[model samples]
Target: MSGLLALLDDVAAIAKVAAASVDDIAAAAAKAGAKAAGVVIDDAAVTPKYVHGFEADRELPIIWRISLGSLKNKLIILLPGLLALDYFAPWVITPLLMLGGAYLCFEGAEKVVHAFAPHADHEIEEDFDTKDPAHLEEEKVAGAIKTDFILSAEIMTIALDTIDSPNFWMQAITLAVVGIFITVAVYGAVALIVKMDDVGLHIAATGRTSGGRALGRGLVLAMPKLMAFLSIVGTAAMLWVGGSIVLHGLEDTHLWAWPYETIKHIAETTAYAMPVAQGFVKWLVAAAIDGVFGLILGVLLIPVATRVIGPLWATMTGKKAGPDGHPG
Candidate 1:
C-alpha cells in the first residue's frame, strides 16, 4: 500500500515536470517566432505575388503547395542543419545570420530602386515563357518554393539563435513549433490576401443587405491598395530588421560598435523627448535608423551585384539576368 502511494506520487511529479517543459517550449517558441517577424512578414508579402493572375479556384491550391514546401524547407532541411550548427559550430551562427541580413538589405534596396524606377515586369517574362496555365502554375509554385526555402532558412536560423533552451530535445520541439506556427501564419495570410477578391465578390453579390454589399465592394476595391501597402511595409521590415541584424552581428563580432551605439543613443534621446509611449518611440527611431542604413548599403550593393556578380553568375550558369536585374 505504501509502495503504491509512492508510485502515484512519483507519477504525479513526472506529470508536473512534463507540463512545465511544455510551458517552457511554448514560451520559447513564441519568443523565437517574434524574433523572426521581419522575415515572416516578407515571406507573407512575397508569396501573394506568386498566386497573382491565377484563377480564384487555383489560388488556394498554389498556396497549399507552397506552404507544404515551406514546411519542408524549415523542418526537414534547415532544422537538422541548424541543429548540427548549434551543436558543433555555434560560432558560425552570427556570421551566417549577418550574411542573411546583407542579402535582405540588398533585396530591400533593389525594391526601393525599382519602386522609383519601374522596369519591365518579371510577370511579363514569366507569361512569355509559359503559355499554358497548368505549366505556368507549376513554374510559379516552384519559384515561390525556391524563394520560400531561402526565406525559411533565414527565419529558422534567426529563431534558432533566439531559442534559449539548453536541452537538445527542447530546442528541437521549440523550433518545430516555430516552424509550424510560421508556416501557418505566413501562408494563411497569403491565402487570405489571394482570396480576398473572390471573398469580396461573393459578399458583394450575395449579401442580403446593402451595407454588406457596400462592405464587400469596398473590400474588393481595397485589395490592390492593400497588396501595395503590404509590399511597401514588407520591404521596410526587411531593411530595418536586416540592418538591425547586421549591426547586432557586427557588435557581437567586435567589429562595428558606433552604428549600433549611436543608434541606441539617438533612440534613447528621442524616447526621452516622448515621455508617453517612450518604448515605442525609441524602437521606431532605432528601426528607422537601421532602415536608412540598410537602404544605403543595399543601394551600394545593387550596382556591384549588377555590374559584377550578376554577369559572373550568368557566365557560370549559362543564364541571363531576368527582367528584375537579377540572374535567374
Candidate 2:
C-alpha cells in the first residue's frame, strides 16, 4: 500500500509539472504570436486573392492546400533552420530581422505607390487570360505558397526573437505552437473571407425572414469594402511593424540610435503633455513616426530594388520580375 501511494504521488507530481509546462508553452506562444500580428494580418489579407476567380467549392480546398504548405514551411523548413541558427549563429538574427523588416517596408511602400498611381499588371492579366483554369489554380497556389514562405520566415524569426527561454525544448515547443496556431489562424481567416460572399448569397436566397435576407445582402455588398479596408490596414501595419523592427535592430547593433531615440523622445514628450491617455498617446506617436520613416526608407529602396537588384536577381534566377521588381 505504501509503495503504491508513493508511486501515485510521483505520477501526480509529474502530471502537475507537465500541466505547468503546457501553460508556459501557451503563454510563450501567445506572446510570440502577438509579436507577428502585422505579418499575420498581411498573410490573411493577401491569401484571398489567390482564390478570387475560383469556384466557391474550390476556395476552401485551395486555402487548405496553402495552409498545409504554410505549416510545412514553418515546421519542416523554417523551424529547424531557425533553431539551428539560434543555436549556432544567434547573432545573425538581428540582421536577418532587419532585412525582413526592410522587405516589409518595401512591400508596404509599393502598395502605397500602386494605390496612388494605379499601374496595370499587364503580365499578370495576360497570364491569367492565357492559362487554363487548372494551370492557373496550380500557379496561384504555388505563388501563394512561395509568398507565404517569405512571410512565414519573418513570422517565425520574430517569434524566435520574442521567446525569452534558454531551454532548447521550451523554445522548440513554443515555436511549434506558434507556427501551428498562426498557420491555422491565417488560413482559416482567409477561407472565411473568401467564402463570405457565397455565404451571403446563400443566406439571401434561403433566409426565412426579411431581416436575415437584408443581412445577407448587406454582407454581399460589404465584402469588397471590407477587403479594401483590410488591405489598407495591413499595409499600414506592415510599415509600422517593419519600421519598428528596423529601428530596434539599429539600436541593438549600435549602428544608429537617433531614429528610435527621436521617436521615443517625441512620444514621451507627447505623453507628458497628455497625462490622461499617456500610454496610448505615446504608442500612437511612436508608431506614426516609425511608419513615416518606413515609408521614406521604402520609397528610397524602390528604385534600387527595381532598377538594380531586381534585374540582377532575375538574371541570376532566370525568373520573370513582376511590376514591383520581385520575381513573379
User: Would you estimate the TM-scores of all the predictions?
Assistant: 0.96, 0.97
Question: Candidate 1's C-alpha lDDT?
Answer: 0.90
Model 1 weakest 10-residue run by lDDT:
122-131
Each candidate's root-mean-square deviation in Å? 1.5, 1.3
lDDT of candidate 2 over 99-212, digit per residue (tens): 999999999999999899988877556545435888888888898999999999999999999999899999999999999999999988888889899899999999999999
Error of 1 at 326 (Å): 3.0
Lowest summed lDDT across 10 adjacent residues in model 2 is found at: 122-131
TM for candidate 2 is 0.97
Clashes of each: 0, 0
* Candidate 1 TM-score versus the reference: 0.96
Name model 2 segments beyond 4 Å from true: 127-130
- Candidate 1 regions off by >4 Å? 122-128, 323-325
